[model samples]
Target: MPTSSSSPPTDSPTTGGHRFHALRVVIPALIILVWLAGAGIGGPYFGKVSEVSSNDSTAFLPTSAEATTVQNRLPDFLGEDAIPAIVLITSQQKLDSADLADIRTLAQDLAGLPEVAGAVSPPIPSEDGLAVQIFVPLDADSEVDAAVEALRAELAATLPGGLTSYVTGPAGFAGDLVEAFGGIDGLLLLVAVIAVFLILVVVYRSPLLPIIVLVTSTFALCVALLTVWWLAKAGIVLLSGQTQGILFILVIGAATDYALLYVSRYRETLRDHDTRWAATKAAWRGSIAAITASGGTVIAGLLCLLLSDLQSNRSLGPIASIGIVFAMASALTLLPSLLMAFGRSAFWPRRPQPIGDDVDPQVAHLPARGVWARLPRYVARHARPIWIVVTLALLAGTLGLTQLEAKGVPQSDLVLGSSEARDGQAALGQHFPGGSGSPAYVIADEGELQDVTDALLGTEGVASVAVTAADSPSGTAPVTADGVQPIGPPGTPAPDPTVDDGDVLLQATLAYPADSAAAEDVIRQLRSDLGDRAAIGGPTATDLDSNNASIRDRTLIIPIVLLVILVILMLLLRAVVAPVLLIGTVVLSFAATLGISALVFDHVFDLPGADPAVPLFGFVFLVALGIDYNIFLMTRVREEALHHGAREGMNRGLAITGGVITSAGLVLAATFAALAVIPIMFLLQLAFIVAFGVLIDTLLVRSVLVPALGHELGRHLWWPSRRIAAASDPAPAAVRADTADR
Candidate 1:
């Protein structure tokens, strides 16, 4: 083993390295100026928005005869286009005449609203009926959003007696989601600033340095967020609300980290010389490789999201990758200039040390020599058993994934408790033999055809069906020059007119509510039952399809990302054997994170298993961040190997880098812990899982197992690299020269 000889840099205090620091500040100021100018000018665009416009008359026409023409010929058509927005009925008992009058008034108000296309009341039994179903057809321009708001406002108004009304639907859900995210922007701004401020204060131990680091990091974060938004607006990327939250956390946390890693090292070098220029150079030289490697691995990991089929996950990958890239650039360029401007005063109250530089009291007693020097030997003896146990436990818990049911959570689950809408659903379900909310189909065909209606009435899931006169809203007669009109009008035995080229229309309603298990099952059966006779179209059908697609994408994408990371790590480490073990350990750490998250949500938090998307996101983030620790530890291991033989190098490397890596891991974990404070459960799960993954990665994978294996493998660890035998082969000037003769 080797020992210190290069003066430990900190043993001799000096004032130097200020020139490079000054340049760092000036360059960043200029860059900020450029960014501000670009922002003011509306940034850049690949193409104008006007390029995507359409001029076809049929595109916007609500009553396209061609659409109706095709609809009549289809085996099924669930007039999803004209489907009424769902409405809830609320009352404590069967609605009295007065209750009915208020409801009618409310319904009339909705009908008269500019956006409402039509309205209807579903026939509901009066026996023990506290609720009734009201259907409102959103006007052609209204869509889901307008209907939810209009109905919500109407419900909020004081009603007759003690009755209460609430609305829930696609529109209502959109409103709720918007409300949930109301103050998130402000909260994120406050949290990020505070977090960066606190971290800088602790690391630099100076008020001004913290402020500087905070400002630079915050600027970098702002640029990243604006970039994400620009990309989203330009259609180069897609980001949901959750993705926005992730972008906020990752940008600030990572940017701050880069600044800390560089600045802290810069401060350490300041103690060695009086010249700021030399100190800056030394810090840059010593820190650049570590920063590059750490940031590179993180960016690489995040980029793995590009392989994902999920648009959300895919978008996160590049956004995070871009953030880390900017952070690295700022650390190397912007941070140095800022440091030179501040000089030794950046340390604030802490006086210049004669023998030590910028040392934190928290790690003042951390081992620098002796029995602790043989940290790798300790790791070697215990690594296998500990690794094995943890691996088995994680693998065992992964079995739960097999049991993971992948389906989209209904909009109902988006709200808390049995909300007014849910109670309304319960009421509707009770009063109606079959839930009144069942999706209805409008089958259209050319020529009057009573036979189509007869066929639908005979179908298995079909309840009582109703159809209205097929008249064009524009007052174009339903009959064209060829005398065409749609199939039947309920009890009317009119001959079905040709929707277009030998087709007719028939309406069918299911015997179950849209959200019920029976409804979904009935839809499947209806599809099979109708065969090629109809085309299904409804929100329920669309929701089911989208849910399945999301599940399928998540199922396939996560494992592919892990496999890619394994291969990348293999090439980076230049060890086929080590990569496999490394991947296994990472997998264990990830599973442990999930298991703990499960425990928290299921037992501690006393909530149900997390929403479906939570697990997928947790998996991606844990794996990506977990690899950061491995890269940190492994890079140090490789550096030490080039200096001391494999055995001594492993121990010395662990001893030297362990504390810093642990500190970083804790800081990163705490950053994730901030997510737990968010109000949403999905974010809470993300926080716990990521925090747990980092802890396991730091303690189990990097600290104990990697060093243990390094010792166990010895020179074989660096196979094919003949330079492995060279005792100062790739010596890092500061640490290696000191430990060279150990």
Candidate 2:
């Protein structure tokens, strides 16, 4: 029989009970104060994340990647590491002499800006004569967003009455990305906090309890940010807007989820014990295993990203693992202290009353009349049918997985709301070579430069090609089948191509938009033809390489994460069958989540497509998080199984853990769903997949499927473990009748 233990009697001075009592109050108070100080110090670091974070795609490529090599050599060939911004000037009619002169004056004015590199190109007239384009290079080392804004301001103020100008190209697109991520620190955090507070308030139905849980979550986030910020500053990890947003959400959701579990145990302990300290100790003891195991499982899964070839993926592993560590610490240490301080008053109007010692442990600890209590009885009666039907339903949902198209989304479609760069790219494509401004760069030996140029020109999407020449006025001498062309009047001598370490740079302008599928296909063809002889990179090639790296990371990391999590579950459960069963159900839940998300993304939302990393991220979060609810239930079930028989213990475990795990799941889901407000396509997709998947796992898999299957299997579910006695006899008729009525 499981017995409730009381605190040491404080009146006995000889027994040292007085000393133990003093330490309880003193230790909890000190823990609370330390967390408060940490939160105060760490809170301000959230706004400073931009100082250490980067969104530059090229920075994330593998060192061995061709794109990374080409990107490194760009400065030597182009004179400066500058991102080009194309200014498109258009008029309703053909430009008159005055309009042409005004455009030239505007271009010259743009060249005077401090952020402008080298020289601004002279206005080049379009074939229709209705528009003129100027290429402006902005120093990549400067504040790109500010420079782009200044250029836009100058163009807006100086453009002639009939001409309209737009800043587009690499720098322009990078500026747009910077602006899109600007709200991550402020808006994302605010929305997540408010969403979590509201959900916690409804779940606890108490004012003070929700605030305590929120404080635990927020303090964990602040501390995590403080740690990650310094790590990024020290150049140990790469920080990006995407990674920062995920870190914030992961910390808050995970902390609150763990807190909810502890709170549930603490509240239950309060009902059985008279003293707050005794209840605190009991709750902490009961909840620590599940909380730590659940947290460790998530951390292990995240750390698996360390094996990823992409730096961005690798960076998230340690960054998020750090967040999980703080989340677990806050839940086990800070939250318990806060709860101990408040005691039963944290429940306010609905505070639980202490039960007499003679009361039944099962009746006092587990709800006997709620929905959770009734659910176990229903599963007990229709165990096999329930598992079979739910399994079939989940399997049917997997059919939609075939509709998933996670190849990758175009860079232009990355930001969900209206994007100036996307609009500019469209306009730029209409008037110039579709890949104007952003060209595919090729670096090869000087002797093979002409051969590489010939290969580029022969490629179907190549509209034009040029060789970087130090002596040329525009820095590039146009390349033709005949070789480099002169820049001056007819018969002028062609400039010699620039050479560094016997390698030369060749720029190929494509006939398709740089971010379009057509351009990616062209770059792929070029890569296939050039092989190791030439290195190719640009905005298009960067996208291609990133997509491929993400695909590779997914393939390599997914299985490793599954295996890591399986090992953790086995060690935690002390049984092979239960861990395997839990893993299988979580995987099934992930597949169903992806399938539903695919159908919703394709048919309902009408999205362009998903990023390749989306599935990998979705799997990592869903599987690790989905297994959390099962861990909570099964750990409790195993504890009860040690006292009662396996059949009775499974019923009691489901009845007691059902409400708390469901509440935790709802809290986690709401926090993740809050990510949708950010308007980033990847965040939005990941938000839905995880949010929906958690609810499914909580309500269906944990509540129905696992419990039902376990009930049917009885002690066999814990096979090979002598801890549970295998019951070969059938359950009593009276027990079945009593369960049916309840």
Best by TM-score: 2
lDDT per residue (tens digit) for residues 374-475 in model 1: 555455555556556656766766654544433554555544433545555555555663535444444544333344455555666666555433343211
Best by lDDT: 2
Query: Whole-model lDDT, candidate 2?
Result: 0.88
Q: Which ten residues in a row have the lowest lDDT in candidate 1?
A: 49-58
RMSD of model 2, in Å? 2.4
Candidate 1, residue 567: the lDDT equals 72
Query: Which parts of model 2 are misplaced by more than 4 Å?
Result: 1-19, 725-735
Candidate 2: tens digits of C-alpha lDDT, residues 1-742: 2223344312111234777878877998999989989899999998788889888889999887888989998998888778899999888899988999989998999999999987788888888888888999998888778889999999999998977788888888888888878878888888889988988889889999999999999999988899999999999999998899899999999999999999999888777666677778889999999999999999999999999999999999999999999999999999999988887788988986676557776678877687986888888888888999999999999999999999988888888888777887888777889998899999999999889999999999999999999888778899999989999999999999999999999999999988888999999999999888899999899989889999999999999999999999889888888899999999998999899999999999899889999999999999998988999999999998877767777888999999989998998898899888887899999999999999999999999999888987788788767787445224645446767665
